[model samples]
Target: MTTITHRLPQKRHLVTDLPGPRSAELTERRRSSVPTAVGSAAPVYAVDADGGIIVDVDGNSLIDLASGIAVTGVGASNPAVAEAVATQAHHFTHTCFMVSPYEGYVAVAEKLNEITPGDHDKRTALFNSGAEAVENAIKIARLATGRSAVVAFDHAYHGRTNLTMALTAKSIPYKHNFGPFAPEVYRMPMSYPFRDDTGVDGVAAAERAIGMIDKQITADSLAAVIVEPIQGEGGFIVPAPGFLPTLAAWCRENGVVFIADEVQSGFCRTGDWFACEHEGVIPDLITMAKGIAGGMPLSAVTGRTELMEAVHPGGLGGTYGGNPVACAAALAAIEQMSSLDLNARARQIGEIALAALSSAAESLADQGHGVIGEVRGRGAMVAVELVKPGTTEPDPELAKAAAAHAFSRGVVVLTCGTYGNILRLLPPLVIDDDLLREALDIVIEAQTPA
Candidate 1:
């Protein structure tokens, strides 16, 4: 397949005030028609997006650093993905893989099995969302191990489904009143270097969590230990070095299935095919989504063949799982990743972003504006934590203000973290270097207080 370049000028341009007239009208319509529960980062409504730029309804072009929350790593409206979806839709939109299997579904499964970590024989089951993939992975673990308990980490985000909500660490928007929550799920302390008051290294931190698990939810009764290799919505928290390897090793010793939730960190988003690769940890079950299908709604649970096959036939599937159009998009996206060497591109983006953010953080600290706590992440996934000046106390207000400032200036950035004090950048791996630098400059300016 030939590479298709973005057509829009790769620069940010503002034609009207942030929302403009059209977007403001739509926002009003949304107030009455759509629920207030569904929130959007940008006030403007997007009409077209490609490469690293989003064109809003009033033709205001905004630099896209959020990547649709890391869904469009190859770029939103990727021509190759669009072509694949069009061709597949023309042939047949959906027969429901359960009713009548198609090559596209099987092809996606085959590709997932080949790409996900581990050389051991593996199998993949598809789903419609990351939550669905995570839910199924838990089901498979429970059935295979005949255990009832599961372990999750503090500040980890699995998904929003019942089981996943229970797995998720945050409580406000995700689990506040929504849950009586699923039982048999336990949370352990994560190895957060920035917030670790104990000052433990990766291996020691792993021991702390392991000790808690052994005492609280004994390994024998644990079905699986699920964690995001790099926690996404929980603030792009990359675990300390040796942390993942230690946890995986303990899981192996105890016979508990180890699951890596790579939903936001998979498919070359983190400089590797999966974030787990950075730590050299092979999970028994790996859940994937987001970048898998180039913005299509598709997710997968890929794992050891023995564990996956243990489930009875017809035990795993859904109505829209692996839709043909989505599968075709996945195939095209994977091909694009390999052919374009997006993994290397992600590394390049990471280097540039890390250097810029780190410098900004240092400069801010020198200027006595210590609100920029720490800048951390890998590959194209980067973030800056905000804290009160001269203290470790979280400053969520500062984060919100910075993001709003960026949006006002025609750049699309996002905020995350349990305390809501992290400004994250997830620009498309295919973004132009100059455009990325310009967007980062805006972000840095936003971080600086007047």
Candidate 2:
């Protein structure tokens, strides 16, 4: 029989073993110098990626279910992305949007304002990463409201910075020895339906959190209450249905800026443009990054024009905030997302994942396997937490095992959650159905008894 080759936008060429020879060499080189903690995720040796497949240094290709930590949604190596990048690179790269502005940067901000959730007169400020976007959100809120206190939630994963670390939930890995973190950042209990006590009903979890901030954090001096509609790294944990709107309502009443950290959940990764739109709640400020620039480094804080304008001149920019190439890539990425209907595609992907994940979890339960206890998330940002089963206790060791097992089978998966027991998937939206199913099957096969 002859082989028929189809030119897939995403390429997969398993020329050598997983991690291949060159990848192993690079890993060894890094192990000698880089910190041990940073070497955990897939050994970081991919040389190229396109659409949904990542190719390693030694010519090994694996399905990239972890889309650069949920960054590249339009697809890896997209023609639009590449063309935009190349065109911008040819025409001068950086002028520091602050020192001298450019059309590309202004256009990107305009696009964000028009597309981001919230119909009010919105504005945007670009930055280098999600962390910086979040930092600016705090600054804008403080300057606008004349308040110093900021409120976050338990089990939330905002970013990795002085202020953001204080906003984040975990400490051992992201925050340990990195603090004394920024002050006046208070954490309220998030409404984790999976583990919430009856003291706060699922539907009223937002009210409960608001009460905490009101009673404990003191809204009198509060600048903002920031939240991820679907908590990302703390686990792909979706808040209860009414939680966001209720929280937003309280913020409105108390004059606290409602900041939505949509870095991980925005740009069609969720069913909507922004996760906050799931409940028709328009936040005072929204921070975004990750999937914005087709894998390029870019982020933005979009919000009410009045609030954004509150920040004085020369207070909100970076040397590389809106790099022209990155801005061009982002414009192309947004166009691609809208043209391809990736938002709807993301919802469909979630449906596919939900059915397969539930069935696989049930099979594992029947077989008495001690991994994959629960599946939860919205759209393509789905997760399954590994556990000992029939208990609330987390099983990080089993999660690590499942991740390694998936990598061994030519699939790249990432693990998150405060306990580090949740395995999450973030395949590019352009991935073909067969490839997605293939990756899911690989994950299933990895869980079977050996």
Model 1, range 305-405, lDDT digits (tens) per residue? 98999999999999999999999999999999999999999999999999999999899899988888889999999999999999889999999999999
Deviation from native of the Cα of residue 271 in model 2, angstroms: 1.8
Number of clashes in every candidate structure?
A: 0, 0
Instruction: Please tell me which predicted candidate would have the highest TM-score against the true structure.
Output: 1
Per-residue lDDT of model 2, residues 290-363, tens digit only: 99999999999999999999989988988999899999999999998888888888998898888898899898
> All models: lDDT?
0.93, 0.86
Quote the lDDT for 132 in model 2: 95
Off by over 4 Å in 1: 1-4
